[model samples]
Target chain A: MTDISRDDVQHLAQLSSLALSDQEVDNLRIDIGNILGYINQLSELDTTGVEPTYQVTDLENVWREDKIDDYGLGRDDLLALAPESKDGQIKVPKVL
Target chain B: MTKISDYISKNARQNVLEAIKRANDKNEYHALLSFTEARALERADAVDRGEITGRLAGVPFVVKDNFFAFGAPTTAASRMLEHFQAPLQATAVEKLEAEGAICIGKANLDAFAHGGSTENSAFGPTLNAFDKTKVAGGSSGGSAVVTALDIVPFALGSDTGGSIRQPASFNGVVGVKPTYGTVSRYGVVAMASSTDTIGCFATDAADAELIMDIMAGKDNKDMTTLPDFFKPTNVKPGLKIGLIKETTTDDVDPEVKQATLDYVARLKAAGHQVDEVTMPISKYALAIYYIVVPAEVSSNLARYDGIRYGHRAEGVATLAELYGKSRDEGFVAENKRRIMIGSYVLSSGFFDAYYLQAQKVRTLLINEFNKLFEDYDVLLGPTTPTPAFGLGENTADPIKMYLADIMTVPASLAGLPAISVPVGKSSNGLPIGVQLVGQRRSDADLLALAKSMEKA
Candidate 1:
């Protein structure tokens, strides 16, 4: 069984961009360990020369006319859904 | 259960009012999140006045809250979008509405459709329609319960893995998880993109067929959709069917096994050939699903970073903190667990060992299904390992909850069209569904076979 460490859990939370509480992190450490252990059973299979099936649909490069379509929603309608919008634009925390 | 014809044949306004009253009376199940009373009434009135004219005129229905719908917020049963009203309606909902189907309310689900049981919903779990003590199978639990309770003739649901079929089995209704790309996914919340499918729950297979036909077709908005191909066909007699041996092992509930065998007997009585078939690679489908699905889930759910639409964290100074804290506050624990697992497997060091390996194994699984389909018209099995469990039964163990999907995920992984048809009930009086799986794009034939099995 693969045992996930507390630090590993924190790193995963970081990668996922989630600010998990210590309690959540602790609980997830055990849960992720057990789940990994279960899924680890797949390692027993030898998958030599098997092409990975990324998608089941047998279509490729489905092209459309390069035209703009709003899909029935206007800019203001979507902007209104944001947490903070001002002067016809959405406001977010400064990246730097 | 109320029939589609029953709704359409009655006065449109009266149908909407009665359906709303039924939804209100069934509050103990907690099946619906919010009622779209005003919109539904106006639509019904339009139908009555001939302003709306179509096949489904005045038919009241429900959508799993994950769809972008009007009249109520598309919550996806999470606090993140608890107040996020949709800017545009989902294509599936719009199509249904075009046919004059009135969406009376939005249904409950596992928050972000991550968990097997609706217990993971930020709102309380939807109780089983048959037995209040047991769970309503989910993440389409509310849709199934509403249909089972006769609150509506039908309801729309999304299936990524066993979300639709598992709950339909638990609730004793016909649930259709159409072939991948069979229906346009525009306007629906994205889950595992490759496996996500739009389906519906109905009291009978014919009703399900009608709903699916109306919704099936390509939309320019969703490029993954296939051209129109879902025309219902009449299933011929003497069909060859495979009864999957793995689905009825000793580990499965005895009553569930019996229910499957009973359905097989009915198939034989109807002059169809049923043979026991084995697909060894299917044993790994659940593991592959957990890996591949979470990988996709991790990527798809990244859009909910509290920037544009969903709940935003207050008092977070840095941009990183805003993303982290808003997500932490918005998603349920199950959603976070899936996201982290996805992150773990998708990380560079583990990518080949986990995600890529699972995809390869997924190919092997699909190959096995294809080989079986060569000789069998369809694969038959019990939709779930057991009947509806108690509300808190599998909550403490995520693996146990995932096990509820074991019988249904193989088809999902392979992008096959599988339907769960109500066969009978358990000794405990809970519903048991028998699943029929068909090869890709065989949705029409699959529904034909299911419609043939209805009790005369």
Candidate 2:
């Protein structure tokens, strides 16, 4: 059995910034537990001294000039894509 | 003149026009989301006028809607992006266009590429090319079906896990998932970043290789792209091939198993040595894939909050309501399921137990693949457990849908180059495909081996 619990699911939802419904939470309680139970099978493997591979590309530290390259799009071009905009700034719902 | 090379070189415009006519004729399939008719015709005329020239000069192709293309909206078969017109083309599309390939249409896919079958597509599931009642094994389902139906000679697809290969197998086309970073992911919609790969579908291995050669390269915009290392090898000395024993178990459909064994027989006849090899960690691949992929999906998909872009809820008074309602309305059930699962696994307290454990298992799986590669030049297996199940067959159970990818997920986890090539067919007449997996940088070699098998 996995150690994942309801509170843990709630904490994860918070971390992921998702406000799941009560039904969703209940469903995930069982789904996450089953998923965790499957993933827990990995604990049997011996990964001693094995290095983790984060990225697949062999090249590293590819630096580029920090100069600002013109994307060639003007304010109108940018604002034209916005569903709501005012005076060149994208309009958003008030935060506070 | 009907050959791919001649068709690409001499009759690009005529070829695209003919393909468009055929696609229009078969209106029942709905394989294409939107056709870039005017743009494609104009580009074809340019190729004919000797204005644009390259290796694939004038060859027309379709891109999965997930890739941002100039002519049509990259909807990703989701309602959220249904009206979202891309400001620019994906780097992959741009690269292919640079080589003189014309983008003709955008193909259908599962919303956010979250499902194994295209049934989860917001627009509607793409019917199988061979049988209308069956699903076009998905998120790259439409891409595969279009190629199989000869709507286009080749199409571009993004494979997060088994999206490309499974569909290709289901449709009897060649599907290639190159080593991660072999092709840049700069403009494609992000889906499990670590596993997401841009690939292609073609009717044959040679055409697939040609397209791969054109698309494989380093891009300054995507830091993860490797320098162009995909050179097709001509050497045909016997190769050390491993037929993954786990994938050929009794659980696999009898026809799929037979097709795989038949292909192995052909490899042996071609003077390549075939041996059964075991990677014990492969058994845990699906579990690892679900945990790690959803964790990434949850993060990657968080950007669609209905604020900055794509769909907004109407009559929303509060910010939180807008986000929740818009997303709940826009995203399909599968997308929500994955996102919630992702949220559950990556939660703080359970991170060590779920996410971290999965990562460790991923490491083990990769190590096992590396060990196998030390002994074998390429790994062989069936691409899917079965081919093209009827639509709605696995819809009731999500795990059943996920299980279809069990044989293909190990390669995705390891970020290895893998391909699905048509070997034979089932007695019931469905196409069966066999998968070939190689070490990270051995994409070209793997394709070359596949091509050699074709000759044999």
Choose the strongest candidate by lDDT: 1
**B271-355 per-residue lDDT for model 2 (tens digits):** 9999999987798899888888998999898998877678777777777767777776788877877887787777777687667
Model 1, A10-92: lDDT tens per residue?
Answer: 99999999998999989999899999999999999999999999998888999989999888779999999999999999988
Give the candidate number with the greatest TM-score.
1
In candidate 1, chain A reaches a TM of: 0.92
**Against the true structure, what is each candidate's TM-score?**
0.99, 0.94
Best by DockQ: 1
Q: What is the C-alpha lDDT of each candidate?
A: 0.93, 0.85
> In candidate 1, residue B190 scores what lDDT?
92
TM-score of chain A of each: 0.92, 0.79
**Clash pairs detected, candidate 2:** none
Q: Per-residue lDDT for A15 in model 1? A: 96
Candidate 2 residues lying further than 4 Å off, grouped into runs, are A1-34, A43-51, A70-75, A94-96, B1-3, B9-11
